[model samples]
Target: MVDNIFKTAMRWALIFAAACLLLWVIMPEWKSVCAGLLLGVFASFLNALMLRRRVEIVGQAAGGNRRMGMGLGSRIAMVLLVAMVAYKNPETFNLPATLAASMVMPFFTLVSAFLHHKRH
Candidate 1:
């Protein structure tokens, strides 16, 4: 079930990334915005992957005595790193677009999961 959701989310993210790349190539004026979006989307994908791995780890440790966290700290760090990069390279990346794009994966995942649930 988790694998299905992860795969669906990743598929959507890849589609979005392709669209962004197409836009970047076709529109020179929107290059910075598209680049920022691409960076954010990439980071979001990585974060999603990390989350999925942590979830699996937690599931495996469910019957154990040790507690496992969802790796929120690492995820937060990744977002911060992306944000800092965008902030430092304003000419290359649009800060707002990058920040906004960074949030897209979770939305995609949520929608995918909801649709899957409804279908089943």
Candidate 2:
């Protein structure tokens, strides 16, 4: 299930990234928005990868799972750093669009999972 979700999220991310690039080419004025969207997509991809790795580690552990907090904390810090940079540079980064794009991963994951289960 996790594998399916990861693949789905990645597919959507690539689609959106291509769309952003096209949009950037078509309208130079909205370059910031496109860049922000791409950044968000990248961040979301990293987040998904980290989550998958954490799950695998947990599954492999025999005793109580440790290091989960460190993993989560680092992810949070990385996201916050990206967000802060975007927020600080409104001229280059469209905060609202970035945030909207960041939400795409989980949305696609859930949608794909639901559809997969329905088909099964």
Candidate 3:
């Protein structure tokens, strides 16, 4: 069930990233924004994958006495890195667009899970 949700979310993220790339190529005026969005989507996708792995690890350790973290710090660091890059390269990437896009993956996963639950 978790695997299905992860896969669906990843598929949607990829589709969105591709669309952003296509728009970047098709619309020169919007290139910076599209590129920023692409970068953010990539970061968010990676974060999602990391989160899925962390969830699996936590699940596996549920029966044990050891504690496991979801690696939130690492994810935050990744986003900060992307944001810094966008900020440094303002002409190449739009900072606001990048930040906004970075937030989209979790929502995608939530929506996907909700739809999956409804379908079943």
Candidate 4:
């Protein structure tokens, strides 16, 4: 599920990049890119949480602690990403980016848990 969420995020990034470059001809507001990033982050996190359903198989497994492998690195990366956004436009950063980034890490962790269960 971690892999799935990362893959899903990558796919979303590609689609978003293309839209940012191409769609600007139609909708010139670069703010749309920011909006899209907000939505993309939301969607990726939602996808991650949805994928966590795979962890339900833990009931059948001979598990011990059964913990998600999502560690500090990914979280640190997300934090840095958010910080970058904040620094790039401190006064101007909107609520959506802040909210979306806040939600992504737990979603990634949940999906990581699902992947752990699936591995067993």
On lDDT, the leading prediction is 1
Q: TM-score of each candidate?
A: 0.93, 0.86, 0.93, 0.34
Q: Could you give the candidate ranking by TM-score, starting with the highest? A: 3, 1, 2, 4
Q: Which portions of model 3 miss their true places by more than 4 Å?
A: 65-70
**Tens-digit lDDT track of model 1 for 1-120:** 867987999999999999999999999999999999999999999998888888778887887955667499999998999999999999999999999999899999999999999999
lDDT of 3: 0.90
Worst 10 residues of 4 by lDDT: 53-62
> Which has the higher TM-score value, candidate number 2 or candidate number 4?
2
Residue 93 accuracy (lDDT) in model 2:
85
State the displacement of the C-alpha of residue 114, model 3, in Å, after optimal TM-score superposition: 1.0
Task: Give the backbone clash total of model 4.
Answer: 0
Which residue pairs does candidate 2 place in steric collision? none
lDDT of 3 by residue, 11-77 (tens): 9999999899899889999999998999899889888888888877888888895666749998998
Model 2 C-alpha lDDT per residue in residues 38-87, reported as the tens digit of each score? 87887777887787788778876747755445678866776777688789
Per-residue lDDT, model 3, residue 82, is 96
